[model samples]
Target: MCPTSPSASIFGINTVHRMSLQSALIGFLISRMLPTPLTPQQIIVVQTTAVATGTMPLAAGFVGILPALGLLSEERDGTPPIHLTWLSAVGWSCSVAFFGVFLSPPLRKQVIIEEQLAFPSGTATAQLISVLHKLPPPDTSIRSRRGYLHLDTEDDSAEPTGRSPSSPQPIDTETDADINEREFVQHEGWHALTYSFLASSIMTLIAYFFPILFSIPLFGNYLAKEWLWTFTPSLSYVGQGIIMGFPTAVSMNLGMLVGWAVLSPLSKSQGWAPGAVGDMTNGARGWILWTSLAIMCADSVVSLFPVVYEYFSDLYRAQILRRGDSSSKEDHEVETEDRLVPYTWVTAGLLISIFVGTILVWVVFGNEGIKPWATVLGFILGGMLSVLGVRALGETDLNPVSGLGKISQLFFAWIQPGNVVANIIAGGVAEAGAQQAGDLMQDLKTGHLCKASPRAQFLGQMIGSSVSILVTATAYSLYTRAYPIPGPSFPAPTAYVWLSLARLLRDGQLPEKSGVFMFAFAIVFGLVSASKTYAARRQSPIAKWIPSGVAFAIGFLNTPSFSLARLVGGIMDYVYRTRYARDGNDISLIVVASGFVLGEGVISVVSLVLRTFGVGVISCWGCGHGLCGGCPAV
Candidate 1:
């Protein structure tokens, strides 16, 4: 049977149908007024391009570009030299052409399930449905069939079972037949306008202003350094949460922080030889090639262990452990077992893609002169380090660039003067990893919601990612051309090279410094803390240590302001999770939080649109043109 549509019920409600139609129309109109509405396909295309071009944060280019053009004052000492005219014309033209060709074909695709996918939880759409229907609170019981609370029913069997209960029974068709007929003629003009305006306004204001408020004291500096000077399309963490869901968004941010702020800086400090560092950072063509071969070897060896175990388990289950004819309950269990098969396939596909992608990269960028043996060794070492790094630091949410920076600084300390290239490549790889992981999560979400084939979703993602590669390449080229931030002046590159050189001089290979060791130690500490907190009460000694450890790490890595910001975020997270999360009627709270995230995206998009049109909302402090003098004309 086909999956039920969320809007079907609304159509059954005469009043709701009328209201929805009106709202959609009004939304359509308002969207036209603000900026051209890009369809989902168009958005996909744009996103791909943005990511490829390293313009994932769209604001980064504009921020830098504007300052260079004397439109906005230089906020920092180092601004990339960007050729605006060329970048703008090329980027916009490509974006327009790609969208026109690709999105137009799928413009009419109906949104059967338009809500953002939620993982480990359900989609936001499910949450909205539960809220609107006033479903019962979620039951924590493991065996309950309904994962969430359901309305009280007289039947005992209908009570919470904890696994997701069978899809809620379909509503009777006849119940709303008469109402639907009577409401076919009703108009909902004002209601539509109100909702659309409300959605847009609420989203816009929150996204734009809330971050500014949150960044007031400590976060202010980091925010300024990372976002203010450049067009970072994915700058707003909240927006990421809303669109991609919280976990994915948070993970991406974590990766970025680790790569950019933590790993890169440390690598540069170690100062491996300039030549070695250069090779590592500047494409590390040799290293990547060797790494791929090493991975293949390791993968081959590891496959045997899992394959043998699976083979034995299957044999035992089918032979000695086999029972008599399976009953209905056993049959049901067998059917449910199939659910896990899809996840396995998805994982396998991802690994294959990674291998293929690495090969392609190596072929395109590798050095011909590097011997296969050295490359292989480098690859093995890099892979080993990556694994260890992940184990020690936890899977970084920071950009891969930072991670690469760390690796280059440490291992290729002998390869000097290429720290800048290393940092950029590292950052790019980190970002790509984030995008890949996020894409997978999103695919999983869609699969869960629609029961769409995982294979299908994976295929779609592959297609989507292919498009992204083109977009990324184009965007990067244009951005580099327009806002050319010289490598020498870029803070990240300078710091990275400096540190990497130092480490090399001091310890030969990147010294396993106290900081690196400490980082690994922190991972163990985090694991222990998590276990203790879960086992003990909320206020247990272990729980106390968790926060202190986190604080210490923050202090070690960041400035006072950053530490302060984290503290504030922690307090807010605590309050929301404890207080708001518990309230049965607090659905609006999630929306509010989501609003903040959505607001960030909207503001970013809007700011970009304005800039594209030569309108500057932000201006220099002392440009003497009254309010109008310095600001870019709208």
Candidate 2:
């Protein structure tokens, strides 16, 4: 929300609704810092439910281009006057959410638990949760090592066994001494996380109060001195850098080097620049902004070629090759409380949501558009597209909902040409359905790792979705009335992109206004990126040096502050990897980083709320979001 650049990502909630859970996970750890630490399962239940609750807002809000399209639509008085109705928008969004819920179980079986696609982000979340909650084996030694941070574990799978030095009454068994030892480990873990939280919070507070430390353009005052680079220190981004591995760091920084250090300055000198390379506000909205978009949006579909083919081929083996006898050992093992939602409930929910959605659309639009056949088509497309969406989510952390939605819109527009409302509803279903399903599956993955019940997680998702219906509806009405989207205060750039596409499609051609070179370059780069990604999987030594298109796109458009903060985080993790931890992804580092993310995120949300209520936070003239003067004493 704070990003002033047009090239900024829309917070990526469609496929990975992670920030809230990330925060909640750390919040849970912080709670345990000075109090009784609940079991891992207990913390998981709270985190999943809390995270699940935030997903509806993703569908409701204009995070991606799909939800934001309505901002561009308007009702003009004329014969057969038509406009997108708020009721229809809310109703259809809810329907898509439910559709995701029902479709997720089967997808979970085929893709997640069975095929085991490397949903890296979800896998990382699961690993973090398991590590945080895992009680050390009873027979494990708890000797003081280098410092409180060092766990001194021989293995992640460390367990106690028969030992002559130990007594016959095994220490690994249920005993008072073992229980106390376990408590000590848990307490120490909490202590370390809390200290990290405090340290991160203090640093963040300093930046907010004194902008000299962060968020200022380097080498000059706002413009004309250096490339458009800000020294913004994002606590959450630092945490993100910790999670993504070293190859990712190098790839992303390489992009920043090329775009910022090279191309940006060159563009400005030639007078073909996007803006002042040093200005943080609109400097990033340069010609390269479009170039970055060409890479990101085009590569989203390009990368999906392999994933979509694999997805359908797997289905073919299950249905045609095996005659629909597709079952696995893990499914049977998970029957008790961790199995898929019942077939009847899922079926009923799907039917009801579809029916409700159609009725709501018809009622709101009054037969001006929105056909029943369109609704059915929407259901089919949404379900199919979800496979592509979740697969992209698993393999890469990128969400393809917006790209997939545009494709659906293109298809549906041809089917019912000139019916904007119908196309939007149809496209919205495809986009939102996949978006919700991807989100739920990520939650399910975390639960699976924590040994929590899948059935329980499904129920939690339903509860969260049901609540989101009311919450999202109210939020939409309130936020729109307050600031309005696509406006200066709430510039929904993604929505603008969607609407711009719609307009161009109506004219039956892409914009011919001199971007061919950029497009050609992007397409070629995207292809090369895709090829390199595939080749890298074969253990090619050269693969390590290949610049990831995804990382490059992020770094290419975003200010150096964004990349540098993440770089620092990566450097920090590498430091730990070399000296402190067995791997860069030590549980201790994750715990601390999680604390950093949660502490800052919580405070920012608070500041937003206070500002919303017309209460002055930290503000001053000539200040780029810095606390300038002393606050009025409370």
State the lDDT of candidate 1 residue by residue for 1-634, as single tens digits.
Answer: 0001111111111111111122222233334345566332222233223222222222122222222222211232122222334434233223212211111111101011111112222233222222222333222122222111222232344333223445454443222322332122123323433443355445443323322222222233333332221111121222222322222223233423543345434444454212232233322211121222222223222322322343455457556535643342222121233333354553454444444434433443243312223333333344333322221111111112223323433443344233322222222232233222322332233233334343333344445444544453454344333222322111112222333333334344433343344345445545543453343322244433332222222222222222232233334444565675434223323333333333443444443344345554342332121111113212
Kindly list the per-residue Cα lDDT of model 2 for residues 1-634, writing each as its tens digit: 2321112223222213554346445645555655687666666666666666666655443443334444434442112323234565466456555777778778776555554455555555665554444533222222221111112245433222111123332323334443443354366557766776676667655544443454454555444134435565666667667655456666678767777776666566666654555332234335455556566666666777777776667667556745545353123234464355777887898888777766765665556656877877887888888888887776555566656777888888888777665666677666778877887777666666556677777777777777777665655554454343444223444554454455545655432221664577577777766776576445367765676666666666555666777777778877887887644344566667766665665554444444467655343323443212223211
Which residue pairs collide in model 2, if any?
Answer: 119-394, 228-277, 274-286
Worst 10 residues of 2 by lDDT: 141-150
Candidate 1, residue 506: the lDDT equals: 39
* Most accurate candidate by TM-score: 2
Q: Estimate each model's TM-score.
A: 0.42, 0.74
In model 1, the runs with Cα more than 4 Å from the true position are 1-360, 368-439, 442-446, 470-545, 548-585, 605-619, 622-634
Among all windows of ten consecutive residues in candidate 1, which has the lowest summed lDDT?
1-10
